[model samples]
Target: MQSPPLIIGTRGSPLALYQANLVQRLICEVSGRTEQEVIIKVLQTTGDQIKGELKYFGGKGLFTRELELALLDGRIDVAVHSMKDVPTVGHEDLVIRAILPRADVRDAFISVKYDSIDALPEGALIGSASLRRRAQLSVLRPDLTFCLLRGNVGTRLRKLEDGVCDATMLACAGLRRLEQENRITQAVEVDMMLPAPAQGAIGVEVKRDREDLTEILAPLNDRATEWAITAERAFLRALDGNCRTPIAALATLDGDVLTLRGEILAKDGSLRVAQTVSGQVSKTLDAYDLGFKMGEAVRDEVGGRITFDD
Candidate 1:
């Protein structure tokens, strides 16, 4: 009898499929497995079925719960996820086996009439599904009106073309992955709009007891990206971050030094707190500590003013 083909589970979105296929190719090359022996299993997640904003619908887990349940049940060998959509806390029975190399960690401004965010007229309506983006943009342009926009990349683009909103924001990484970079009117700088924690990274999750699968996927992990994501996620975890909270964080590693920048905003974007912390750290735990401390500091600064009440 032959072993079953290695199944890689992922959401059915175009970008998700692209990432899954990329992982499939990399795994095949590294493991010397024939493409026939490896396959992708598309799974529909709760986030996909919802038409409204994600913040109101329980946030990040909606994107990964079904696939995770499949993993726990041994329905799939591994699951690929967009790290940004993953919650800071994870299922105890699973582990992120690998972290793919990072992609562009900046947000892209897309608009048909305006050339850039700055060029938009006052009171320009902006559409975004991310509370962080809406809050950050509100801080920059208080006069702008925001409406909920939710869908896959192509759907969002189509909505933009149909003038569903004057302008919108998307991850530059997704656009580049989908080969739709031309749609980006402006690649907003990180300083202008800090990215969500773990944005632009792909994570592969497997059952904690799957040592063989872990070793097989080990080669795909990038240490630097892992360090950065570790810190950012730790920061988010420390703050108990969720879709309801407009939180943004980015971590960068340079040699032995790691730096983490974080921002938290009021729901209405009326108040904001931002901070940066850096330290000499060579280990993942050290990176995590650095990020967690920063999150705690920021949370303390904000006190009880910010509320998550819907």
Candidate 2:
């Protein structure tokens, strides 16, 4: 009997399609399946419909729920997601079965006129939809202002050229995937701006009961990326963050050691709290308890003045 085709679901954006296609290529390579064996399904998401700021329409899960529903309904065998957009908590019946190797975790500075963030004159306006980016940029250039710029990679770049703001910020990974890296003015250093938790990773989700499919996709799982994402997401989970929340975390693994850094900034970027933790890798690394502890430590230091929703 012939093996059944594997249907992969993803949002219809160019970057999303690129990620899904990457998974398709990898799956075919690993399973020795033909391109015809893996099918890509383009699904619409609530996040894609909202015309204004994302915070208004429920942020974190909006981009992922439709594709997830497709998985739950058995309409697709696997769902590929930008891990950063996935909620910190899991769906009842679905689990992340694999993660592609990580890409650059740094934010990229993009502009048509200005060459870099620092080169922009004081009081320059920056365009972005992420509270995390806004808060972090505020720390570096408080004099700068921000306006909302929502949509896919192509849309944002067009808006930038049309003068939506003096410049904009985007993830380097997204640009690279979209083959728009040439448009980046500079790749912001990590110390200058720590990335959102799991910023540059892609996660593959499947129904919890699909052990067969899980095994087939297992080879694509990068152990280092998995360890780092587990830790970083733990930090987000502990902080109870959504996209509206100004929270950032990044984790790195070197040999048997894992190091994680997390940050929470007030929406206006006036107040911030940051923390870091390092540990030897073990079975417990997968548990991500260290990241949870780190998040709690920062939360305690910041107190109740934060308005995570706005």
Candidate 3:
């Protein structure tokens, strides 16, 4: 029997389309399906509709729920997502079947007038929608002020060029995927600015009922990146992090060892709680355990210090 064409769901942004096309090519290669056998479904999400600050609108799942609904209704066979946009909570019936290899897991500082973060003058205006970035950058340069800049990679850069702010921050991975890496003035080091959990990863989500598709995507999974994200996300899940909270985590693997570092900061960047945990992970589950423990420790250390109200 001939299998039906595979429909891939994704946001309509340039970066989203690029990611979807990449996944489409990979799926076709693995499943021996021709280009015509695959379809790309561009779906508009709430996040795309909101021109105001994301925090004011529905935050978590803002960019994902519509596509997820499409998946639930079988409108699409699979959904391709930027893992960072995905909420920390898991969907009961959906599973991330594959995660592409990690990208440059660092923030890119883009400024037309300044060469780098250090070059920016005090009191200069900066733009970002990520609370994590604002908190970390505020701590580094308390004199700077911020304006809300929210959009896809191209839009943000265009705004920067039009003098939206003195500078802006973006993920290096997004620029690379969009073929706009040349716009990055400086790739901020992880030490200077810790990235969000699973920041640079691309996750392929599928309804659990689709076993055949799962099998096809299994070969695309990068075990190392998967475990690394597992650790990072486990830390996020343990903290119950949301857009309101400023939380950041990163995990790195070397041989059989996994190390996770997590941070929770006050909105104003006044107080920060950070912790690091490392363990020998002969199995992937070990990374999850390590991250959970680290998260718990950080939470305990900052008890009642700052709370992100629901």
Candidate 4:
């Protein structure tokens, strides 16, 4: 009898490689499989295919499409992805079977003259790859200049030190995962800047029918992150958010309560609508209901103020 070979698909980036190995390591521990049992198969996605320009290629899914294809084609039995980059909506044939322990949920501010987004000089330039961060930055400091920057975490940080733009925004979780927490000048709170749909979460995507794999990964699941991302993704799906839209959300689970905060900004950076909701964590459907309500509320609050469409 021979053991089954597990092919793990992942994006071919430093962080992607790091995360893929972490997933494989954890799975092997839980399933009693040796390192040789799992093989990491790297894929280049649209996100990686683009350099120097992210807005032109696409948004979040740039790194996911290729690995997802590998999964669908059965070339890989599992896929590892940063939950925030994964998207709010799941696929018909695929599902996030587990969420590994989440990392920090803050945005690192890297700069020489400032410790945070606020300390930056008025009209100073800042770079970021997320529409959510750009839109929120607009609402936060209308005076500062926001530019589109695309690259891996290291590349972005290097640009900041090299003075490519002044300062840039990146997820604190990623920084922490790479043992670069000290680089963060500030870890902006969600109240001030709503995080992306699933920031800080690491998810393992497997074929929906793979119950054995699901059970194998179950021990590593972080219930709080899983639940929080579930609520946040539902919100994004309800709002129909995509490349063109500037939307952000974050949810927190404490005991039986789940707290959600969602925001939507106008395309031109003039108006903003934000909402907050809290409910029993078990009522997952309420998360969707609240997300929809928040979007509708923001739409009404802004009152034709936002027109960005994807």
Candidate 5:
């Protein structure tokens, strides 16, 4: 008798579907499973249903909660997610089984007229839903105005064409995955705007008890990307970060040395605290410790001024 197919749960968005299908193809290649033996199951998430800013609702978890619940209930064997969207704190029963190779860890500046953020006219309107982007941009161009802009990649591009806002920002990884790299006016430098934690990586989550699935997915795990994101996410978890807080972190590995950069900004961009730390990290735990220490240092500097929406 044949065994049941492996079900992969994901959100119902163009980019989400693209990530899921990519995983499906990779799984088939690695495990030598026929395409028919692997399935993609699309599920609606709160992040998709809400037409307003995520901070007003529940923050990043809105995108993964439904899929996670499905995983807990045995409705899916695994779930694929954008690592940036996955909350640092997750259900104890679930674990990220694998991380695909990372992509360009940069934010893309998109506009119909302006060539880049610096080219925008004074008092120009910038549309984005990310507190990190808005806060960072506010510091760079205090004359610019910001308004809430929320949607998938296509929706936001259409809004830009419709003249809803002068400019917007998106993840370079998402645009590349969706074949919309041409839409990027400028791939913003990390020095100007550090990316959110775990940006540009794909994470696969599975039940902790699924040793079989873990082994099956092990071939897809990218060790360097795993170590980088492990540190970044640990920084986020240390600060209890969420959509409400403007937090950014990026980790890079050089041989056995790991360097992590982190930032915490006020909502209005009036104040910012940033820090960098480096250490020899032979394992993921070492990376986590390095990040956690950086986060604590930044948090302590910011003091009680850092507040969350909840």
Candidate 6:
């Protein structure tokens, strides 16, 4: 009656715009409305404007703080987010209304000179801001050097070709969404480097108690992806994982059994721990416990000196 009174807020980035447009299109279709009937709002977040290593910020919701407040204040009807930046069992006011279908859950190595991470020569410079990527890179190729690099997908790849770095790590899904998949010389397989929890997934956030919005968003939810993240995020939350710490997790579905693989590395990337678990979807919490147990085991393997940068 009031034109659905829907306003979708998202970060102002190429990828964010793309994801928001998608949700906008779907909402328009389902609600029997036109694109003009929906409103799109862009907000700049602390995580988006920051130019240095993300470790400096208190991890989780670094990119969605503004939008979260918007939801709380009813300035916007809903928010779109990349779920990896979200906290599990945390965040007071906003609620994740739906987790859209997941994407390719692997990191892609884009370089004009190299085909894969191992293919790069010794002393090669790898550009990435994620502690998990840095630690794992160090373990696999101790000769490689990691410098703090932050920017949008296009900006990072441009820097790589501009000689700022020999190679850069990015979400494979992001590249593909922008129709630049050919730039991916090699996609880091899950076995080689576990991806972040909720990587390559898009999530819709809305205020709790908004049943009308929830009903509208429920159609986009993917049950398998939802369950997979249930295990992944649970593990991350249990380990107190954050950007300052090097932690990676991934989950896959094989029929009704979900397999979760997780890894944790010390700051220098010297100490590492890895493990895997399989369980039913209904046993999601049990699977999550297995991952946290593995992380705890890793911490024991590394001792308490695993330096998570201050």
TM-score of each: 0.98, 0.97, 0.97, 0.93, 0.98, 0.93
lDDT score of model 2?
0.91
**True-structure Cα RMSD, model 1:** 0.9
Model 5 lDDT tens row, 151-207: 899999999999999999999999999998988899999999999999999999999
Query: How accurate locally, in lDDT, is each candidate?
Result: 0.93, 0.91, 0.91, 0.80, 0.93, 0.82
lDDT for each residue of candidate 4 in 1-310, tens digit (9 for 90 to 100): 9877898999877888889999999988988888899989888888886765454566677778878888888899999999877866667899888888778877777776687887888999988777778778888888888777878888888777788898888888888878888888888987788787788888999988877787788897887777787888877877777777787888887898888888877755687777888887565566667666666766667675677754
lDDT of 6 at 122: 88
TM-score of 4: 0.93
Give the TM-score (vs. native) of candidate 1: 0.98
TM-score of candidate 6 relative to the true fold? 0.93
Model 4 regions lying over 4 Å from their true place: 52-55, 283-286, 296-303
Candidate 6 lDDT, tens digit per residue, 1-310? 5655589999998999999999998888777767777889999999887877666666666788899888888888989888887777656656777888898988998889988887899899988888888888888888898877788888898888899988989999999988989998999888888898899989899888788887788888887787787778877876778787788888878888888888778877888877777776565456566566666765666577567756
Runs of candidate 1 with Cα error greater than 4 angstroms are none
Flag regions of model 3 displaced more than 4 Å. Answer: none
Of candidates 3 and 1, the better by lDDT: 1
lDDT of 2 by residue, 1-310 (tens): 9877999999999999999999999999999888899999999999999998877787879999999999999999999999999998878899999989999999999999999889999999999998899999998889999999999999999999998799999999999988889998999999999999999999999999998887689999998899899999999989998877899899988887899988999988898899888987775455398788888888898888787863
Between candidates 1 and 6, name the one with more favorable TM-score.
1
Query: How much lDDT does candidate 6 score?
Result: 0.82
Output the lDDT of residue 54, model 4. 53
